[model samples]
Each structure stands twice: as structure tokens, then as C-alpha cells.
Target: MRIAVTGREGQVARSLLATAPSGIEVITIGRPELDLANPASVLPALAAAQPDVIVSAAAYTAVDKAESEPESAFAVNAAGAGAVSEAAAKLGIPVIHLSTDYVFSGEKLAPYVETDPTGPISVYGSTKLEGELRVAAGNTDHVILRTAWVYSPFGANFVKTMLRLAETRDELRVVADQRGCPTSALDIADAILAIAARLKADPDPALRGTFHLTGTGEATWADFATEIFAQSRALGGNSATVTPITTAEYPTPARRPANSRLSGDKLAATYGIRLPGWKSSTEIAVKAILKNAI
Candidate 1:
């Protein structure tokens, strides 16, 4: 299957390109070729790719920065996403769009289901929620996969940030009150490919909706940081002591959800796909990153 993915250099897109199965052809376009912020560029570029399916993987992901640039976030995450779905609808293909856990208010004590009411706390989350709405409205054959705490060896994510910080600091302060699943981009890519291949052969209406796709387990930023250090130490890299802090202590321009955990029951029931545990995936990614460092 030919999969046209947006965001050439993003973690998910990079993982998609690297880990696609033997029969799948993954083509990524970004910037000048297909800028999400520019709706005019969507149709022509997507038409030329002539893909069997489209993976809308790109977005304005800067959580804190989005507070200061809501317009830019809306343009890319909302309007641009809608345009991609519209173009996919024109080609009569399925679309797999990546969403986030931030759509929730994070007040829920338990994990969030697909039907949970959305209450985004940040501009980034609000824009992403709008994107989800637009994509659903624009295309009938769409799968909105909402993931959380995504990190990979290829992108600027929490894992890399912690490792980079450890290079100079002996102690790192991370928020312990916040809790969510830490998903791996590689696992997400595998899940996307499986869904795409299944949809290509049979576009089941049962599979066309928002589903939570994340790692099997959950963790706070502090716990996540601790594990990162553990993995780094095992890989012969620098490790730091993770000092637990509250969200208030490390305030940003945007307010993060205290709890953004999502349930994966729907995805497993429908697709029989489940990502690895957070620690397992983090270890693999950390090892890979450290290997390159050496």
C-alpha cells in the first residue's frame, strides 16, 4: 500500500518511513511541498502522491509556544488538517490522523475512553481538538488516533530532553502529579500501518472513529524521567537524579492536564493492536539514542 504521510521530519512520520512493512510504500511531504499551515498546498501535493491512504501526522506540537501563537496552531492543526481530510475524501481514501490526550480536562480519576467529553486546557489541545472535529466532518473514512507522551530516537521529545539535560545537570526536577501513558512513535507507526493495510483491504465502518492508542501502562513525568535515567545508565550514558516536583513548580504558558491517561480497549477490540509497556519501549528508544551518541 502507498501511504502519503504529512510531516517529513516529525517523530511519527520518521518512524512510519523507517518501520513500514515490506509491501508498504511510505512517502512523506512537508514544508514547501505540503505545508499544513497553507491550505492551497494540500490538494496538488497529495494528488501527485496518489496514495492509497493518507496519514495526517503533522501538527503544531509546541505546547508552551502554542499559548503565544494560537493563530499559527489553529492554522496548521485545525484548518490544515481539515484540508488534508478534504483532499483524502476527494481521492476516496482512508485517513489516519494523530491526535493527543490533552483534549481532556485531566480531572478524571480514571482512564479516558473514546466517548469522553473533551475539555482542552491548553491552546495546543484546543487546536488539536478542532482538528479532530474538522477531520471527522471532512471525511467519513477516518481514524483519529489519540496518543500521549510520544517520544522516539528521531525527534525532540521528553526522553531526548532528559538525556540532553543530564549531560550538564546532576539533578532534574519533573512534575510528579501529572500522569499519562508514554507511547513510542515506532509502536504508533506499526499500529498505523496495520490499520492502513486492514482498511485498504476492507474499509470497515466499525473502525472509522477516534480511538486511544498509547503504551500499555502509565507514568508521571517524574516516573518517566527516572526510567529514562535507568535506561541511560544501562546504556553506559549519563544518568541524573529526578527530583519530583508539582506542576505549579514548573509552570508554563499553557496549563497541562493533571491526568491525561487514555483507555486502549476500543483499539484492541477493533484492531487487536496494543503497544508495548512504557518502560519497555522507552528502554529500546533510549538504547538506540545512546548507541548513536557513542
Candidate 2:
């Protein structure tokens, strides 16, 4: 089957390409070929690819900076998604769009389900939520997979940031108040492909809805950092003492959700797919980073 991936050079896209799924032709479109900020780029790109399935991994993910650039965020996340969905609809193809857990207000202590009402606290969250709505509305065959705290070997992410910061600084502080599953982009890419492959086999209208996909475990930023550094030391990498701090201690332009944990029970029961624990996924990412560094 032919599958076209947006944000082709992104961390997730790169992983999907590296771990290219079996019996599938992967077409990657990035930056100059298709920019999410430019809505006009989406349809033409989709038409050019003429893919059986379109996986939109492209997004304006500058969380903190999004607060000041809400217009650009909305344009890319919302309008851009709408364009892709509309184009897919024309081609009678199914679309898989990546979303975020930030769409929620972060009030629940437990894992978030797909049915929960969203109340975004940040501009980035609001924009992504808008994108989800537009995609859902524009296409009959659409799947919005909302994941959180995504980290990978391919791009700039929290894990890389912590690792880089820990190198020069002996002591590091990370926010402890917020919690979420640190999903690996490679895992997410696998999940997306599994769903896409299934959809290709049997096009079901019932499968068209928003679903949450994440790692099995959860942790705060501080806890996650501690594990990262601990693993780094075990791997013979640099070691740094990571201190815990509240979200108030380190403020950003965008407000982060306190609870970004998402439930994958639905994904398992429906798709018959299970994701690995954060530790295992993080280990893979660490190894990849180390290999690249060497």
C-alpha cells in the first residue's frame, strides 16, 4: 500500500521511515514540499502523492512560543489539517492525524479517555484541538490519535533537552507537579502504521474517531529526568544531579497541563496492539542518541 507521511523529516516521521513497515511504500513530504503553516501546500502535496493512506505527522509544536504566535499555530494545526482531510476525502482515502493530550484541561487525576471534554489552557493546546475538530469534520474516514510527552532520537524533545542540559550543568531542576506518559515517537509511528494497515484492509466507518495512544506508564518531568540521568550514568554517559521543582518555579509562555496521561485501553481492545513501557522505549531512544553522538 502507498502511504504518504507529512512532516517527513520530523522525529516521528524519520523513525517511521527508518523502521519502514512491511509491504508498504512510504512517501515523505517535508518543509519545502509541504509546510503546515501554508494551507495551500497540503492539498497539492496530497494530490501529488495520491496515497492510499495519508498520515499527517506535521504540526506547529512550539508549545511555549505558540503563546505568542497563536495565529501561526492555528493556521498550521487547524487550517492545514482541514486541507489535508479535505484532500483525502476527495481521494476516498483514510487519514490518520496526530494530536496531543494537551487538548484537555488536566483536571482528572486518572488517565484521560477519548470521550472526555477538552478545555485547553494554552494557545498550543487550543490550536491543536481546533485542528482535531477540523480534521474530524472535513473527512468521514479520519482517526485522530492523541499522544503526550513525546520524545525521540530524531528531533528536539524533552529527553534530548534534559540530556544536553545535564552535560554542562552539575545540578538540574525539572518540574515535578506535571505528569504524563513519555511516549516514544517510534512507538507512536508503529501504532499509526498498524492502524493504517488495518484500515487499508477493511475500511470501516465505525473506526473514525479520536483515540488516545501513549506508553503504559506515567511520570512527572522530575521523575522522568531522574530516570534519564540514571540510565545515562548506567550507560557510561554524563551524570548530573537533577533537582525537583514545581511548575511555578519554571514558567513558560504556554501553560502546561498538569495531567497529560492518556489511557491506551481503547486502542488495545480495538486495534489489538499494545505499547511498551516508557523505560524500554526511553532505552531505545537513549541508545539511538548515543550511537548518533559517537
lDDT of 1 at 29: 89
Write one digit per residue (lDDT tens) for candidate 1, span 152-205: 999799999999999999999999999999999999999999999888888679
- Evaluate model 1: give its TM-score: 0.99
Candidate that would win on TM-score: 1
Clashes of each: 0, 0
Residue 84 in model 2: lDDT: 84
What lDDT is obtained when candidate 2 is compared to the true structure? 0.88
TM-scores for all candidates: the values are: 0.99, 0.97
Off by over 4 Å in 1: none
